[model samples]
Target: MRSSPVSRCRMHCYFETGSPMCGGGTRTVFSKRRAGSGVLSPVREGSTLTHGAQKGSISNYEVYLGALVGTLLGAAPAVLADNPIIQTLYSTDPAPYVWNDTVWLFTGHDEPNSDWFTMKDWRLFSSTDMVNWRDWGKMMSVETFSWASADAWAGQVIERNGKFYYYVPVTRKGSSMGIGVGVSDSITGPYKDAIGAPLVANSAIDPTVWIDDDGQAYLYWGNPNLYYIKLNEDMISYSGGINTVDLSSFQGHFEEAPWLYKRDSTYYLAYAGHCCSEDLRYSTAPGPTGPWTYRGQVMPTQGSSFTNHPGIIDYKDGSYLFYHNGALPGGGGFTRSVAVEKFEYGSDGSIPTMDMTTEGAPQIAPLDPYARVEAETIAFSSGLSTEPSSDGGGIHVTSISNGDYIKVKGVGFGDSGAASVSLRVAAANGGAKVELRLGSRTGAVIASCSVDATGGADVWKTISCPLSGSATGQQDLFFNFVGGGDQNLFKFNWWQFARK
Candidate 1:
């Protein structure tokens, strides 16, 4: 379980009508700083954004605000509303990893509204709360593997010995499919090919890695057939020879995409069963390489996609299954999106069948609006797309049009409420406004900031807007774009709130 960081709190008086009372107490707020830094400005006397508790000057409002902020200081609500967890792009072959208290999601990107499996590179996203995922564009690509020409397919990542290893399927130039590995010190990586050659050149796909309790690592991948190799501590290499799992003892039909994991003393292997329109099924074994027994379906064939892939993990005392489906607006077999569902194992250790849902996974924690949050960190959005930031650091929300909006769930503005908001944006065609709304896209407007041309779409600037009109308590925050033009309004990078 993750603990909440100590927050810099303030006091404010509110009327029964829910408007700020103002003038009764000394209002204190904090200056904008990078989110998650845990550093606050030194408290000064009579400052609007002061920090720490004010002794003897406490009032009922102060007590109420203090207690309210304290009670809600921990995890916030989820920002997600439905399936296809990410709406910015078509993300498929979901691979989620938990490290350093965060879930790092790696997926293959499908070309916009393509007809085939047109994948070029792999993408990355991270989240503390399951709903609002932050986009980290293009972790590694076919370009990352020099010898590989095309097909950046399904893969999995595992962390070992302070190094992160990514095992993925790629096609070596003129040759068959091979499993390639990349390594980096950071989970959000500038990963390089660990070995310039393919780790396993077996003409197979969908690689999943598992590190056992005894510290032995295993790599599993294939379609129509299942294969595994005992990986050395280095992870880039394997010991002994490649081994195959016999399918005769399997109960259900097996097509491809095998995910191996162990819970308690039982080993589980979940895979896509049957081709054309595949269903998610699994089997169990006592060890990593099993004389396996096929279990029933994990998920029956559903969604718009003709194929499905599964990635499962136990996070925050909950079991989550990550998979992809053709459920987006232009989604199909080629244009797929990732979605997750929270599930529990049966008392006998069998996975109960689950249905694909738009609600996705429930928010395990609430989002802190007082902290700096990336524009790409979204729960639900419409009429927008994301791209590599103009500043070249990370991704920013882009392709935004008038009337398009982004929704962030469970924003804890606290009882004191927000005083102002800061936005980092860039505009090629200027004259756009960001309307900060509460509850819904058409909800109560708390603030709006005008955006002017920044010379180019990539040229960046920061703007601030003063907030007002009952923006208190924990509520869903929406960034509604309003502008006039056929072109995009502006590119958004990040946003932060100053406490009232």
Candidate 2:
């Protein structure tokens, strides 16, 4: 007995019998004799033998079983390792912070199809491996602040004494943009207004928070004019009045979006320079607040977005620059998406010019195929969105149309290969097919599973399909969707594979 390819079995068994199994009727026993051996072998008695049969001896039941088994066995996995890490939502003002083993990213949600910066809230996402970002959803919003009337703009979060503090700019009722502080016990927060009033209300914005070596925390933010305040140990209050930074040496246009960080006693102020179409420029200071020396532009004026924001961090021994651009479909200045780049610091602690790219930072490590991966964790996606799942407090891939797909990169299946694939999905309309392809969209289809309606879009049901073929080692995986008409096909929550 030999296992047949999944495609051949699917074509011969499914199309011919209309049943998943060959030789239609329920059977008490099935057997397959080895080719040329002539010895009847019963792998299971009073049970359906769903896999492997002698050539030409495959019954309709066996063919259906073989196809199902192949669908499961050949079920491959995928990963997303491209720029604009979060595909489901448009993110801007990427603020990344390292906590324990994960890089937590906080960003502003750009309203879809907006002509202006009609942002209303902030978003949270995290990733251990840069390739896959876990969407934590809305962490804070304008409604979180009593004094805020509108505009949930660029901000930064820093943990102090187990409490997390977020500094952001929002529109005040009777004034222009003002900075406010939000506090929570955890990094991913349902934070409340730390203070009922604006922290620094002199029309400030784009607050970047950093604590110095001597335990002094500093908040830097402003548009055209840069300002810094020494935050007291309470983190909610400042020791003195806000001090302005002199920008005489910053030669290029100094606009806004200041990212303040220190590396080996060198304090760097990376900001969005120039107006209209801002570029990334930085200056060095001797201390947290300083008479700075300009260090040329870090990134020239480029990318589709007119304005840019910078968020820099060092993770897993690698330096990463997180920024935003109008790169996604229907993206623009008001609908920007966050992106990241890996770079090295000069010996003098200066940042080299970084560029936006579709090929984002390399994966810190290969994805484990045996572990469950969320469907929303995509490298590159088309025609998809995500929402909260009903079964549990988790996210699922949604807004799927025919021909929509997601690509996950560098998925390691190992040498023995996968035995089966299981996907937790739900369909309101049903009749959707998910085709697992390796390497590319038009690549070899390892397995295809038909989705049945699970009553509701959130009603998740696990579907297991047999899989075949050598799905060993590292390879890019693509999940190509197919369904009738233009309606959404199904929602995918998570997927995993069993080892051979």
Candidate 3:
């Protein structure tokens, strides 16, 4: 059967009014574009990395909001994220590719290892914020037509020149099964195969294309002979034709699905070894096709369709891994759901470390709810590097940044003037407003609605003016701060780490 194609945000734009872009006085939002829309304001300086507190490489960090900022005016604190940038998508075999701020996940909506492609269908889901998602519904199915039918497996989606192409893997009744090519002008569409036949049929089951520097592209696929074929400018087929290699050097066992990409000059090939069952063991190689060296196990979630089929993509100067895992919380169906994690590259450029957490890690938080709704928990920078700053007399803030959860506890407050000490913040540039919590040292947040910003993306936010600290010392605060506009650079405020 033919297959289909599939397809963050910067921190820093959360403060409103008096932006440096606006010359630090007063300006409304009409003068600016909304956050995460990929629109950016001309930078107005003030975006340097200022480190006031740092002894060494910092470890971990936290952010929290309790009910205490106001007595008469109380509101709920915003939620923090944990790990696994994206916990799940509608289907598995998740192959994610980034386009603009949106993350496109093309996956198969069928049962895991079902050996049934006839019943299988493919779908596409999109996310602008990586937190909230927009599902386009069932995209293509074996039942969709007559030319192709059944056993849809692992394939890839790539855009070249102008159009999008979907390379689908399937098991034709008589033919052993290879990748068939499909075409669509839009990422989400009712696509039709290119040559009305598989692009490189019978080459390998799982096919993925990696476009390298020098305008050259290579196809990575298969089992015994991990294969490759340079793609033409059209990206419809191979330029130098399909090339196959023996993946013996690398410890690829039962290896099938393959995903490859190049970073700097290093080409990375990540594939699954062993059967993709619940006890699935994942491994990777350094080069696209080579003495593929074996790394440690990537996942062990079990084959409820909860296996590893990684699709690596680069966006906003960072790398992310898109794969699958068992969605059956009850541990039943081989239901595969798409998930993601931030990637860490090693010094020697050896094997990379992927940070996966039940909580969202490697992502900026207090994200726009309208954005892609990902996992709830987030991974924060750890260590006592800095604290939120505060007003000299009331509450003491030590360090501050975007999307951090700080813990506050040292001072006792009078419930009466909650509104006065309610903790307010505004960007040097005019943006938007929101309810910030200046929680009491007691429970969670009491009096709320204090701080507000535009949830600025990559563009950095400098807290030239901040809430004052309490007369008492050591006020506890959770760092849930965010920095940068989606397109700008992400930097934090001056952190008073452990003091001078």
User: Distance from true position, residue 489, model 3, in Å?
Assistant: 44
Candidate 2 structure lDDT: 0.74
The reply for model 3, stretches above 4 Å from the true place, is 1-90, 111-119, 143-145, 239-241, 252-254, 276-297, 300-306, 329-333, 352-356, 365-500
| Candidate 1: count of backbone clashes, pairs at least 3 residues apart or interchain | 8
Candidate number with the higher TM-score (2 or 3)? 2
Please give the lDDT score at residue 495 for candidate 1: 98
Give the lDDT of residue 426 in candidate 1: 91
- Model 3 C-alpha lDDT versus the unseen true structure: 0.43
Which digits, one per residue and each the tens of the lDDT, describe model 1 over residues 137-176?
8889999999999889988899999999999888889988
* TM-scores of the models, in the order given: 0.83, 0.82, 0.53
Give the distance in Å from residue 427's predicted Cα in candidate 1 to where it truly belongs. 2.0
What are the per-residue Cα lDDT tens digits for candidate 3 across 166-227? 77776554656656777788878667767656666653567887666667767766653567
Cα shift from native, residue 341, model 2 (Å): 1.2
lDDT of each: 0.75, 0.74, 0.43
The most accurate candidate by TM-score is 1
Error of 3 at 270 (Å): 0.2
Range of the 10 consecutive residues with the lowest summed lDDT in candidate 2: 1-10
